[model samples]
Target: MTQNIIRWAQMDDIHDLAYVYSESYRKAYVGIIPDEFLDQVSLNERDQYFRKSLSEDKQKIAIMSLDEKAIGLLIFDFQGEADLPENSAEILAIYLMKDYWGSGFGKLFLNWGMDRINELGYANVFLGF
Candidate 1:
């Protein structure tokens, strides 16, 4: 049987997180966004962003692994955006490897994120692109 897990992401997972972010972003945005722009989505830049953002107090990241291999990422802010309600949480990003698309893992991660946000005392959620 295949085992799937969603767990809190740590600094050590930065590289995989970056990979999922850039790869999925490219796959999802191709044609819709400018090719030149999508071509510039570097893994190193994403890695650096995760390195800095992962340390923030209100930000949370989760990794979705299937049989011990990381294939998806979820990023959210428990403190939410300034324009949102005080008790809201914001979903900053969610990405999955193109290979895993339509396999239902994306919905799983979203449900998990919502549960986590509620557990953290946020009564509402705002999804940001």
Candidate 2:
């Protein structure tokens, strides 16, 4: 059996997060979004973004691993949207490798995020696609 784990993302995880974020976006949105838009998705940019975002106290980023191998990324905000209620949390982003699609890892990963929100005492949640 594989060891599935979900844990907070750290500085050491920036590269893997960027790679997974870029590849997942490309593979999942290729046909739905414009090629030019997709072409602009750069791993370097994502790396820098994660580097900056991870330093912020309000944003939370998590890594999904199977047997110690990084396979997905989760970004959330405990504060939720400015326009939304104060008692809510927001799921800013979620993505898993194409190989893991339809494998149920995504649902498990999402549930972990929800559980975090609930643990934080949030009564409502919002998800950004």
Candidate 3:
């Protein structure tokens, strides 16, 4: 059986995390987002973004793995959009490799994020995408 796990993302994870992000986006948003924009996405840019996110106190990013190989990424925070309730938390991003789709990992990750949000004392949560 696969040893599925979710843990706080670390600096070393930026490379694999960025690959998952870029591939997942390229697969899911091909038409919705301009191909040119998606094509321009790079691991270096994502690495820098992850670095910045890790520096912020408000951000909580996690990595999901199976048998020690990372397969997904999750990012959430207490900050809400202007249209959302002030006390609500937001799921900034969530992504899993295409191979892992429909295998219940997404549900597991969502539940984990919700549990974290509830633990943080937030009564409501919103997922950005």
Candidate 4:
């Protein structure tokens, strides 16, 4: 119903990212990941991890927003020293709120991420499931 855009994650986005993480995980991973695991993924834990990740300065996070509300999150490992497969960075995770599914946001987000990598001058990029 509204326009959405994807952008890099910031400290200000931690809260909304947590919300999207819960919503998306419950819906998308229901049959793939253990229900208990999903249920146990506490916001506090995720917050701690996100905070720690922010501190790391190597892992990167991106969020998709609709009307300024965070709806999806993407994380990638920035490898400046050719740390990943064939010197290509590997995406760690990409999660989106179920409400955005079938609206073609996923591919947009993915392609946008790749473009970001390109912007960073990364000639090769890959994602791991």
Pick the TM-score winner: 1
Q: lDDT (0-100) at residue 82 of candidate 3?
A: 86
Given candidate 2, what's the lDDT at residue 86? 76
At residue 96, candidate 1 shows an lDDT of 97
What's the TM for model 3?
Answer: 0.90
Better candidate by lDDT, 1 or 4: 1
Q: Write the per-residue lDDT of candidate 1 for residues 1-129, one digit (tens) a residue.
A: 999999999999999999999999999999899999998899999998989988764578999999988999998887656789889888889999999999899999999988898788888888887
lDDT of each: 0.90, 0.90, 0.85, 0.82
Model 1, total clashes: 0
In candidate 4, residue 31 scores what lDDT? 89
lDDT string for model 3 (101-122, tens) is 8999999998887888898899
> Which segments of model 2 are wrong by more than 4 Å?
none
Off by over 4 Å in 1: none
TM-score of predicted structure 2: 0.94
User: What's the TM for model 4?
Assistant: 0.88
Model 2 clashes, total count: 0
Tens-place lDDT digits, model 4, residues 1-129: 677888888887887877787778788889899988888877777887787887777788999998878889998886644545555777888998888898888999999998888888776777676
> Residue 2: error of model 2 in Å?
1.6
